[model samples]
Target: MKKGFILIEMAIVVAILGILLSISYINFTRLSVKSNVDSKADEIASMLRDTYENGNKEMNFKDYYIEIIKNGNSFEVSLISHKNSVRKTDLKDFELNIVGQTFESSPKYIYFSPNGEVFLSNEKIEEGYDYNIDDKKFSDIVIKKGEKISKKIHIDDMPLGNITVD
Candidate 1:
């Protein structure tokens, strides 16, 4: 046997390195995509939670709610008070699945009261009760970043609703 490696051996080594590199690249891509999806979901959840928790502290009488709507290629999450936007966040590269029925071209909404109640409609907020609160009217907001990756933001549609993400 010669001291140096043959041409076939060199070719095999290069091919193996290329294969490994490709695999690593693919894995990195998948991880990056997953990270993006998770990051967006967390951002959304935080926005909703912050608004729900602190919104009524300043103006207890003002109705506070979150508006989530599809805006072209991105989604818009706006915290609304007295029919005006308090804060807005725009997210890209995802889809928002509103489990509850939207009100006639209006955005999906989660209204909050000073008493910690959550409602899908703000129309009946001042009436002191939701029009329908049968314990099964929970509205789900699902954010999906592809066919395989997704996150759910469950907003309990009841007297005292909690915002949670996963």
Candidate 2:
């Protein structure tokens, strides 16, 4: 009686395993890309909220603004501060990348007043606004004075069509 499997049988088993692995790898790559984009969006929203909340604090409050700059496949988030010097200088400008994503339109700058209100440059964001990317409208970040800050992601034809951030 034979005590071991034939060479042909071993090769067939290995080939089957390889095929299954390749299929799984493809699916995982797609899911991961989607997740990265979603998380980056969330981070931007959260940063805006934090800046607003901390704007009124007396410890280190000095007019903070967020500037989004896009260059090809990468986007940068800049944290800028306006100092009341003799020259009215902009100080402490820090920038970071969005990673694997780019803005659909030109750069946008949002300012947070000392009273914790949202503003586009010097004017307040009285009505709601939509942040579009790649020519697709993803969500609306509403900024109404004397009301709670809220955000909603519109998933019309997005990659993750079922995702909604509230």
Candidate 3:
């Protein structure tokens, strides 16, 4: 017959709500980190694909290369256009990092042939040099010739690892 809950009931309700909110906040943070990682990977892949497609056009017969450089916990991906001094510029450059993720390989320099083939400067995709984002043990990230650019996330828990490029 009570019109309002007693103090004990109100406290219990507040506690339950707090617990639910904490859980939701944790999940949200985890998803946010995963989303950020996925977004960065997708951006890199897109840039690579664009470079490959544009190189295939043979516009002015210029050479295009995607340069991956690692400095400390961060890495950068840049599109280098080899042509006239004025025309030579970085099409896209990005510096990103995920707390504890490490790159199990060294810096990679991928060249895009005018014929749309993707390969390293050595003309071959080097093994044991794939990027390991989030330390999920993911491998084989070389962009193969005539293959679509794609990446997958391997996050299974919260607090993703920092990135390290060898």
Candidate 4:
């Protein structure tokens, strides 16, 4: 009788272990994907900062494009290619939670300057950053001096593609 009771206890323990292992495996897979996406965002941010540093004064604003996308919990940043080619390496990085839906709107922008600034519509401005409050117009972000600069062009009509900034 004692042997029989021990055998039943072992069976129950094995079942619980199997359940725990399955849950852990599922969670691990999800976490891995989320981490990869987050890491990509960080890379993109760094590239933008570098671009601003390199060309705030010397290069033409038309030469570069910065694209940001908010998809649920994941985000992607990329540089618009010169020929409008969407190369995998051209994508800056993936970010997580850069913009929340609670905010007034989502912005996918390009920054012409090394300071990581872009020209956005007045209605899109929410908090922080600089803008013309009265007219709802935003001037280009300057690192030190104030100037009217243009950086973003809206192409929402185009679907998400190499040239599209949606």
Candidate 5:
């Protein structure tokens, strides 16, 4: 009398476990990518805020790139580290995403009038005028998991003009 399954039955169970494990692994990888992208977006936003606060007023958007690299469970942002004034991390192949660009038809850049009010309809950069961080400089960068790595992030602010950044 046998109390256990046959060898053939055990082999079938092993195959089923293998399939399940593979599926779980694939799902985990996808989730990891989503998490990494979100973290990168938040980090970039913080950096922009800090730059704005430092009185670094420039009408032109500072072009920057975001790199995602493989190392371990955690991901890192690659850039020139200010303190060390050197490349922050030695990275392998990464997908570069563009961060800043000002469009003519877009209100991505807001100028301030002489009276300290935000010039609503002006398109040209005024002389001696600086960027007001309070004006809410927007970005259009988007990060996602899979083939589409980046896209313009848009937000609707109308009946007022929309807030957009890239």
Candidate 6:
């Protein structure tokens, strides 16, 4: 019955605190990763929507091309009227499923028409292909940070694409 904690009691208290801190740190790391992945997914989905809207609304640009490059974990957008930009993200290894087709190494393209439609393609879009796309189509863009964390963005088959994140 001492007035202060003995050596063994102090050691036990320190051990318990260390364990709790370790657990909290691990959980915090996991949550941070999840947050990063989710935000990256949302950014990609929003980029697609913005590209479509900009293409349709801007009268000067004949067409806007959004080319996805998985190697760089980035996408570049270009317009016929010389407007071009690129977006780079921290996430990588995106699994893009378009019309049941998987795009891995090769690049993919989603071009918007001033006519108010969006189309996906494997090759670089050409002038002739602008108006050749049929009715709207559905596509999925899966953004992944690693093996464990991921988010799915669905682009529905509607004019200008109806995008949803899950």
Score every model by TM-score: 0.72, 0.50, 0.55, 0.45, 0.47, 0.73
Model 2 off-target regions past 4 Å? 56-62, 83-106, 112-166
All candidates: CA RMSD (Å)? 4.0, 12.5, 12.5, 13.4, 9.6, 3.8
lDDT of 4 by residue, 61-121 (tens): 4445555555554344555544252422322232222221121344455443223334333
Give residue 76's error in model 4 in angstroms: 7.1
Ten residues in a row with the worst lDDT in model 6? 74-83
**Candidate 4: where are CA atoms >4 Å away?**
1-6, 68-77, 84-108, 113-116, 120-166
Model 3 CA deviation exceeding 4 Å by range: 1-3, 59-62, 83-107, 114-116, 122-150, 153-166
Model 5 bad stretches (over 4 Å):
56-138, 148-166
1-166 per-residue lDDT for model 6 (tens digits): 6599889999999999999999999999989889877887787777777776666666422345566666565443233223356554434444444555556645666766556555667776545444666643446766666587778887666544578899
Instruction: Give the best candidate by TM-score.
Output: 6
Among all candidates shown, the one with the greatest lDDT? 1
Looking at model 2, residue 96 earns an lDDT score of 31
Residue-wise C-alpha lDDT for candidate 5, range 20-120, written one tens digit per residue: 99999988987776556555555544443432322233322222222334354333444322222122332123333324432233223222222222222
Error of 1 at 33 (Å): 1.5
Whole-model Cα lDDT of every candidate shown, in order? 0.67, 0.44, 0.45, 0.40, 0.40, 0.63
lDDT of 4 at 132: 30
Worst-scoring 10-residue span by lDDT in model 5: 79-88
- Which has the better lDDT: candidate 5, or candidate 6? 6
How accurate locally is residue 91 in candidate 3, as Cα lDDT from 0 to 100? 14
lDDT against true structure, model 1: 0.67
